[model samples]
Target: MVKNLYMLPEGLPEPVEDGACDHLQGLALPSVTRPATSGGSVDLSELPGTAVVFFYPMTGKPEQPPMRGWNKIPGARGCTTQCCGFRDRYPEFQALGVSVYGVSAQPLADQKEAVERLRLPYPLLNDTDLKLAEALELPLFDYDGHRYIKRITLLVEGGVIRQVYYPVFPPHLNPTDVLAQLRS
Candidate 1:
């Protein structure tokens, strides 16, 4: 059977909260420049106003087979769904003057493909060098000899992180959750 990238499989394990991101709140974003699908590097620290950055492991392409044991890894699945969710709700964020971004350790080519395939309104930043991840001390996992950032979301304003969501489960709903927090 063909796998559906947009639907999370039933019985997918839920990721538990870890204190890895606890210290992130109220910290100034580091001056890490990452290549964006929009065609230029962005310094998270220099972004003005509110911004939402959701970090995922990687996005799987439809033409390729799923990563080995991908579904079994908690928070490893749903990159595409999460991206689509943000794409769908991008207008709301734009109206609120919030910039949205997706980050992953995936290469720029892969991220570009995902952005085009998903029709994402926001750019997906390439963290292949892990500059942003290391600077922020984001949690990471290694699988098949490759390092990937664990699912996490950050709400940043004026270059400082004001809120952090760790072990973000049911990834598709993460954007909604962020929106709620922003509206509150």
Candidate 2:
């Protein structure tokens, strides 16, 4: 119920700015299919056009405690806020011929709860097996027996990654940043 403490935590170092995404640009979209929170499945290889896929670690249930050390792991927190940002900006992204999606290593059922609770406009791609993470070589961290993908956004055009937004801070502001990148 509390805001992600790490979004702008006063003293902690930001974990995402240290060249984590340097190798990600121009990476071909991974050919994988995963269940979506909305229904059916989303095939990365089959995305029609420009697609915005924001990858986050996980979302915590309101009634449960987050994974151990969730707040201490830089870039590990704020999936919900980040998703909401994309939700608010879905219209703009859609107008630009860009389809927005959220990806995480959570179960489809958990993702469905988030979609329903947040009223997300887009489907959340479920990657419980971390297959997509392995395919993309995305940053990963483990906690209490679970592995989570680090928060990063990919701008894929024609099935190739065009831009990588790494170290997304203040997670809710990410969609606006993505819009700027697309416009420029």
Model 1 lDDT tens row, 10-126 = 999999987889989899999989999999889999999999999999988887876778889888999899999999999999999999999999999999989888899999999
Model 2 lDDT at residue 159: 83
Q: In angstroms, give how far residue 77 of model 1 lies from its true place.
A: 0.5
Model 1 regions lying over 4 Å from their true place: none
Tens-digit lDDT track for model 2 on 1-184? 4545224445544675777678879878778999888778988877778999999988777677545556788877678878888988899998999999899998888888899988999999999999988888888888888888988999998889998988888788999999999999
Deviation in angstroms for 13 in model 1?
Answer: 0.5
Q: After superposition, how far is residue 179 of candidate 1 from its true place, in Å?
A: 0.5
TM-score for every candidate vs. truth?
0.98, 0.91
How many Å off is the CA of 23 in candidate 1? 1.0
Model 1: lDDT of residue 82: 93
User: After aligning candidate 1 to the native by TM-score, how far in Å is the CA of 59 from where it should be?
Assistant: 0.7
